[model samples]
Target: MTAPHTGGCRCGAVRFEASAEPHHISYCHCGDCRRASGAPVSAFVGFMADQIALDGKSLKTFENGPVTRSFCGVCGSPIAYVDERLADQIYFMLGAMDMPAYFRPTLHAHVREQLPFLHMPDDLPRHLKTSVPRPSSSNPDGTQS
Candidate 1:
């Protein structure tokens, strides 16, 4: 867990505040991630859903495989991901945070599809195509956007 958090999308329509810490912070570099963020990887921060307080308007979402992706309809900025089985937590976009600087990616998952030029530390485990991430690359790695 980190510090208290606050964030929203590109559009101001959807917003929220969390007076809790974050867990399972990492960057995912997979085909789905590339498509969602149009980058080598997608940086995400996970949080317990009950701690969040939404404001203004509701968000729209699409099913991207196992993740329920939420985003602001007005601005189209990706909001969060709700696990189908565990609705208590949400994976939110790191870029959507009001104070995003505090977070840094620990490792890059789904390394099988990482862009050739996208340089990241290789000391971390590189999963081939599929893996249920544990916190660290070793025994088990384990969260966020």
Candidate 2:
């Protein structure tokens, strides 16, 4: 694996580099992840927090309990998600990576919450929910006022 992999927000306002390879990569289908990314599924690469370096100070964070999601303040592009319970790691938003192809999702999480219109065409393992409980949601995605 490469010593350093680089990526940034869509508008390039928030840049970062990860020195270590990810511990795991997967597609998160939880409602919180979907809403945060504005996508059907959110792909992420998890790594030790100490291995990543943020190039700028343009990161704005939103918290849901112990989990904090970071995004580019200028462009609203999701950057990373940190679960305080898992303090040693950071989940980098895969779409924000300069070389997304380098990271392949190995499984699917929160499969029960996946949108009806979405489908997983691959044979990756699917979990009814993630190993850790996601923020529970009684409302549908994008429907809350």
Q: Which candidate number would show the highest lDDT if scored against the true structure?
A: 2
List model 2 lDDT by residue over 21-134, tens digit each: 889899999999989999988999998988989876888999998789999999999999998767588899999999999999999988989899997799999887774443
Pairs that collide in candidate 2 are: none
Tens digit per residue, CA lDDT, model 1, 6-118: 88987689987776887656778778767777666788887888888877466887896557788888878877777665557787889988878777766667776778898
Candidate 2, residue 125: lDDT = 92
Clashes in candidate 1: how many? Answer: 14
Candidate 1 achieves a global lDDT of 0.73
Off by over 4 Å in 2: 132-145
- Estimated TM-score per prediction? 0.78, 0.88
